[model samples]
Target: MSKGERMKTTAREKIKQQQAAQRQREKRRRVVTYAAVGVVALAAIGGGWLYAASRSQSEEAAGGDQAPVTVQSDGSVVMARSGVEKPVLDVYEDFQCPACKQLETVSGQTFKNLAAEGKAKVVYHPISIFQREPTRGNSLRAGAAARCVADGRQWLAFHDILYKNQPSETVEGFKTNDLVTWGKEAGVTSPDFEQCVTSQKHAQAQLSYADKVIKEQKIEGTPTVKLNGVALEGNVAFTPQQLRDQVTKAAK
Candidate 1:
């Protein structure tokens, strides 16, 4: 072939090669775009599925039949009672408060024993004192959920479970679903308990009760103990033995 013809042929080949390369690039771009869209779609679907499952569980819990709650005159959840003549042992606590948790850990069983033996009646007033960010919302929700548990006559067990599974103070940890899970762990398997917890059914009532007790009783903080309407000396006013002794003295 002549040199000019050869050059023209080479130029045509280069153009063809360029077109092929462009096509390849476009194809790869399309693949990447499609893959990205698929990822987003899958994520959305997964998120929706999770949300639906959570809602279904909550609904099943709420719609399930359960017994009614028994409210005390002082707006406390009666955890245990031996008899009408038993001295009243009122306990004001916040679920999210570490101090309250500590008090429960230390004195819970003692109080339960006292109630069982007709020495005292233990009344739990779950209040919200940690009304700051990250803890307040969950605290109130858990408190309301406790009321639900009380309806089922499992308030003390569920209360102990909550303290046992207490999360850090920095994060809002008691998600409604989590509360239901813990309630189940605490032997609250009924649908009514789950529904009440998930819906936070007694949230407003709990808040009002807390406020009323706080105002009326002049409560300054949580884990406040009262023996027959008089506040205890301090948080550690009673060891197990000391509590028993005091109850014995009060009974006589």
Candidate 2:
């Protein structure tokens, strides 16, 4: 219990206390570093999400006109996705598809008026499933012939008549020889028209297009349609009234 010994012991204790304090300060520094790292990570994730959303909007706005589909060789009878500002309908229909015929019959002038006024744009995707050879009402033959009429500036007329008299699965609506007669009804006069109908050159294009559409969009049935590329109920028929409602809702 000498005073010098007591002083030495106290000094050792003081050194131990100082080391413990330094350890605590290092621990605090580490805690602060981890907290700062977490905050930075959260901010980065938030920024990435915002950037992706903004880029999507920019791309949507920059969407260009659809490429002109070749219903005609002159590049005139062009069918495409209409880029008209509000309430554009992009419809996929087969010329021999009975459902499509029904829709056209129901929405005929109403649709025509909408197109004429530019309030709506109707993009008809003429698919050829129901028109094939022999039982040739709903297959490639109808589609190619439609292209023939469309090539000469009678697209609308051809569209209407073809739908109106859509031949049933058993009966080909208009005979091949009768195409010349039908062309006159659509205002296209060509001795060459019959030759084109018989030529079957347009079949190559139609088949290629149908294959492309099926692969890209995953469409399964006839009259598959989309409003702004959003697929809807395909098994049943939809009326014009329902279509109008969908257009309004989508625009909103």
Candidate 3:
């Protein structure tokens, strides 16, 4: 119970407190190390996923093997594998038609796939059914631009681009510059193509062909799909999976 005894007890208590603090610090360092490791593991997994997604996108952009596109004398485009011909699918579409764009959004790939597999001969008949002002012009110009590149080996790509970039019916769109730019984007660099798009060289011919088909086939709408000369119902025409099934059945 003297001064020396009291000093010794205080020093022992101080050492215990320091040891507790050191243990707390070690626990915190362990927690931080585990959290950092977890974060790195998650980041590595995310990076792998991102890389896979990027590669998939690149493959899609490359646009793997497609069927041959032949421009008939009548201005319609026929796509099919070599020497394979049956189950003709006639697609009548207007570039400015919203419903036609919707059809393209849903079943465009089905058409391409069918033709690529040599299961069907897909005929693209670009038409202008709009009688109104701006919409009519847009349809004509886009249809003519399509014809300009019908045999340019990029027609399918250009066709998709047009529908992807279709503007409102009230607006004046599909201008010559945009058409030419899209043609270039579709890999059409010929001076003849530029001139044809600029002049809308095939506009009258496209109109005539559309008129002929409309009268002969009794076509009433923009997205009129006929498989093997029989009109496809709306339910089967616009749905991608159903369209594919129908075509496959027809092929068999």
Task: Put down candidate 1 lDDT per residue, 1-252, tens digits, no spaces.
Answer: 999999999999999999999999999999999999999999999999877554323111123222222455434766444344467788898989998887776677676666555557777788987778788897888888887864435666678888988888998788899998888877876678878888888888888888888999999988798888888774333355556567778778
TM-score of 2: 0.60
| TM-score, every prediction | 0.67, 0.60, 0.73
Q: Which stretches of candidate 3 lie over 4 Å from their true place?
A: 1-64, 150-152
How many clashes does each candidate structure show, in the order listed? 2, 4, 0
Can you write out model 2's per-residue Cα lDDT over 224-248, one digit (the tens) per residue? 7676676656422255445555665
- Candidates 2 and 3 compared by lDDT, better number: 3
The lDDT of each candidate is 0.74, 0.62, 0.85
Which should have the higher TM-score, number 2 or number 3?
3
> How does residue 88 of candidate 3 score in lDDT?
92
lDDT of 3 by residue, 1-252 (tens): 999999999999999999999999999999999999999999999999887454332111115578899888887889988987888999999989999998887678778888887888999988888888899999999998888875536887899999999999999999999999999989876679999999999999888988998899899997999999999985677666567778889888
Ranking the candidates on lDDT from highest down gives 3, 1, 2
Error of 3 at 146 (Å): 1.3
| Highest-scoring model, lDDT | 3
The 10-residue segment of model 3 with minimum total lDDT is 54-63
Ranking by TM-score: 3, 1, 2
For model 2, give the 10-residue run with minimal summed lDDT. 56-65
